[model samples]
Target: MFYFDATYVLLIPAILLSFWAQAKISSAFNNYSEVRSINGYTGADAARKLLDANGLYDVPIEVIPGKLTDHYDPANRVLRLSEEVYYGSSVASIGVAAHETGHAFQHKQHYVPLEIRNSIVPAVNLSSNASWILFFIGMIFSIPFLARIGVVLFAAVVVFHLITLPVEFNASSRALKLLESRGILYGDEVKGARKVLSAAALTYVAAALMAISQLIRLIIISRDRD
Candidate 1:
């Protein structure tokens, strides 16, 4: 039977941090969503401007459904922004738009970390889904070999999460600098943009922590089965 003990105890901090990060991002996004940019540029406009500034005129921007679902698809060379971020002229919208643009910039410049992250996308996706299934199966059957395999697979997920940190941080950093340098946000408006980006960054940090903690628990459980 599965029981909670020291293995679970080690995960408490990461779990708490994940909750806090979620709350922080939600609050920051909501707050900044209401604060309009001084220049009255919609999120799409901001993204286009950034892309044009970077000489990526062919990169198309599309409006997609869902909240906070903005992303840059390097494969398709397109930027997909959610409704709020696609049409809204608020500081939060612009910040989110710019952050995705940063990814495009990274792709254009061949940012090593982003390249590495993208290269492992397939492996990460496969492992992330399979790891839990393998782990639970091993737990149910008390199979040490299966559990070890599960742990190894899950370790890839942890590595993906860790590598994701630099990619995300660099994107946010690029967004902030581009926003200020390009005169998209002025004075205190930059601070608002920074706050939004910073809060979003915390979510990535939380994810890394949670993944690491889970991996540790898995390692402990695998050892105990021996």
Candidate 2:
């Protein structure tokens, strides 16, 4: 509930523009994906092909319920695709599936950045949920110590966001290079896939920026404490 300053106002437009750009990119990729398939394969099929091609056939691909809920869990070596992403035969699906497969490939190679990011997951998960709760309680009770605890907890979230960036970027980079080199996507399709992955990457960037902004806000609030 803080007033918007010049810096925040500038950031608001930047974030909004990025979101708008991403929406356009996503819509374009979704349409292109639905219209074209490298081998006329579904998302599941594409993912399997990529995994097998990389000698990662042991990686399992499963369909979960939802839209755009696809993710790869290195721990279980499972590539979870949402119903739409798993079954749909679209350029978007192919791109997404390939992107996730990239993560699997990274794991196979023991990618260091991913290893670091994965290592912090539990701590990040715990902190993101706990921080605001602690901050609220501390504020309500007029206790500086609880607010300080919230500050510490939020630090974990900021760190997590920073760590996530490289992991995501590398995954997308791997996907793009693989798609192009393997002819998984042709000319326009390659461009579209790049757009899709790039836009998707921005969401993470936005999340990190938001986390940083919130951390700054919290610090400002702490400074105002009597």
Candidate 3:
């Protein structure tokens, strides 16, 4: 009863907070994208400079299509960026490029968290899609036992997201330190980089919070049936 009451009471504020966080992060990203960099280097160029500086000269930086689709693939040893981020000569671009490169740097040095995340990839992929569907199906059938089992499976998705928070935060931290120590960006550029990374971090935080809420909601619904 206490759990249900707590979960129900918190749902409204949680949903509203999620919306607010998303909007804030999106706005910060947009603002950073509009601000120019000191070196006049494009996101792709900054990425190249960082990679080359670190002797990762062979890692290709490509401009892929879409928004915020940037990532580094250790399997192919490529850093992919969206058109806006890859070509734009803005603080946001540099921040994103540096962040993704941080991932590559991590992969190169065999970071344990990234390694753990990579290991869970296959299972996470399956569970991400299947868990919610199974949980909903069980609820529709009025089977609390089945729903509870579905929730157990769904918990893996939450765990993956929780683990991801640290990986992302660490990447951002590395990116900021690299930019600051190497003097890659000047003036308000460092602040802008911090803004971008901090905003991105919030998205991960929001996702984890959402997962927690979903998990709580499922538990409440199952208990009601008992």
Candidate 4:
């Protein structure tokens, strides 16, 4: 019955877009990953160069397992890079690495959106876990008030997704600019990095759309029960 729900009409396009975005990122990353940067600097090296240039000597780069699992941990002030991006000298690798480093820069500079997103993380986690439980239980028991609460809570997820768009775009923009200005990647190599980052950005856009669509579905379902 859940799978057969009528509201899925609102979800299908976002779902399809999510699939397409994933495919685009995979293809773009894999393709550009093969094209080595002219300077032959590994992803780790690029990250180190950026951090050092910014006088962030305390932030260490760690080797994290899995492909494309790279991220910046603000709490510990560390850069965690996936195996491919950590050791790779390819354009995609450095681009991804630089992107993560960009987060550290944002953290140091106190970017407002990043700060707000971090602050809301606890509530978002609670809302994500409990929203569905409340919605389903309310629907089962015919309690419209509880169902309305669920929809409101679910809206938090959409807000989080919306906030993520600017954070992601800013990081990618910083990465590309730093890569070019510092000569980490040059000429057509920067183009490859841009392609990779652009494809990656689409995934966030797709996620935001999916979150919005899901929120709409929840609202419609809640209202129908009223």
Candidate 5:
């Protein structure tokens, strides 16, 4: 009953922002991906250099096929990059690669936010799914308490997204700095790299906003039932 209620309109802004974020990242990445770095280091090469410079020689970088699906696997301590990023020496590729490697830096240094984020990941995973189930069942049965519980659970998802902002931003900051310092990108090239990372960061911001919007909608619906 709550799913398609007037409350559904609350999501419009977030939905629009999410679309804008996706488009921003795509445009920025595609534009910069065409501009090769002066030093000519592919994403993988830049990542390896950064990792090795930080004494993270053991961490491995692997290429995976995809478009901007790159990520750092903290558990396995491996960095996986998309085909474009792993091989392309473009500004966007190097920027994305450096951002993933930045996560490695955080891991090696035991960055507090990163650790905290990792610790709650399991709960967030469960909550993300269970929150909807509980909310739907509660709304269908008019169990305000159950729906409220769902709201609480979803709050964790929101928290995860919030913490993710700083983590992602910090990693991007690190990547930009490292890229400049390492001479992988300089002057206008560094500016382009920053643009790529900044665009990517907005996607995280959009996710956090969407999560918060859902939580607020759930709270309103549950409170009405109460």
Candidate 6:
């Protein structure tokens, strides 16, 4: 019965694209992770140098355990890097660290898009968790109103994904520029960082596309039940 649903068919392209994006990022990261930067700067060193250069001395860097789990927490004014990123001196490590540092820069500059994304995080979290439950209950009980409500809630997630595109792109752009301007990466070294960042950017694009496709699929499914 589930396999016969037209909505599932509509989502196939998105599923494929998501898989491709994930593979691209993983490959790019793996390849660059083996190539060390000329300056021998670890991810933690790169983050600190970038932050200090930008006059953000107070923002501290912390090591966390995970692969590619690096992030900047605006609330705590801290940058958290994974084990490899925090200790390794590879191009991939510095690139990922710089990207997170870019987020800290955005927070310091009061970037409008980042602020907007942060503002809706709580609502987005709630809606994302509730959307599936509401949709399944509505479908099982044949309640169009509840199903519509679920669709509307899910729309918030799509909106969040859309807003996230600019935020992510700007961060990568900042990372590349700063890495070069600050003389952290030289000549052909920057190319490897660019590849890693570019691959990461594609993942965001794929995510946005996937969210839009799913939203459209839900709309189609709701209309058919009517």
Q: Report lDDT (CA) for all predictions.
A: 0.93, 0.80, 0.84, 0.93, 0.93, 0.91
Candidate 3 per-residue C-alpha lDDT over 1-226 given as tens digits, one digit per residue, 9 for 90 to 100 = 3233555664676677778777877898899888888778888888888888788989999889988899999889999999998999999988998999899888888898899888998998898777777777777777666778778877887888898998999998988888777777886898888888888888888888888888888777777766
**Clashing pairs counted in every model:** 0, 4, 0, 0, 0, 0
Model 6 TM: 0.97
Off by over 4 Å in 3: 1-10
Candidate 1, after superposition: displacement of residue 126 in Å?
A: 1.1
- For model 6, the superposed segments whose C-alpha errors exceed 4 Å read 1-4
- List model 5 lDDT by residue over 121-161, tens digit each: 99999999999999989989988788888999999999999
Residue-level lDDT of model 2, residues 44-150, one tens digit each, is: 88788788889997888999987678999988999999887788777788888889998899899989978988898898889888998888787667887887789
TM-score of each: 0.96, 0.88, 0.89, 0.98, 0.98, 0.97
Question: What is the Å distance of residue 65 in model 5 from its true position?
Answer: 2.0
Model 2 lDDT at residue 59: 88
Candidate 6 lDDT over 22-121, as tens digits, reads 9999999999999999999999999999999999999999999889999999989999999999998999999999999999999999999999999999
Candidate 1 local Cα displacement, residue 43, angstroms: 0.7
Worst 10 residues of 5 by lDDT: 1-10
Sliding window of 10 residues with minimal summed lDDT for model 2:
1-10
Write candidate 1's Cα lDDT for 42-146 as tens digits: 999999999999999999999999999999999999999999999999999999999999999999999999999999999999998888888878888988777
Which window of 10 residues has the lowest lDDT sum in candidate 1? 1-10
lDDT-wise, the better of 1 and 6 is 1
- Ten-residue region with minimum lDDT total, candidate 6: 1-10
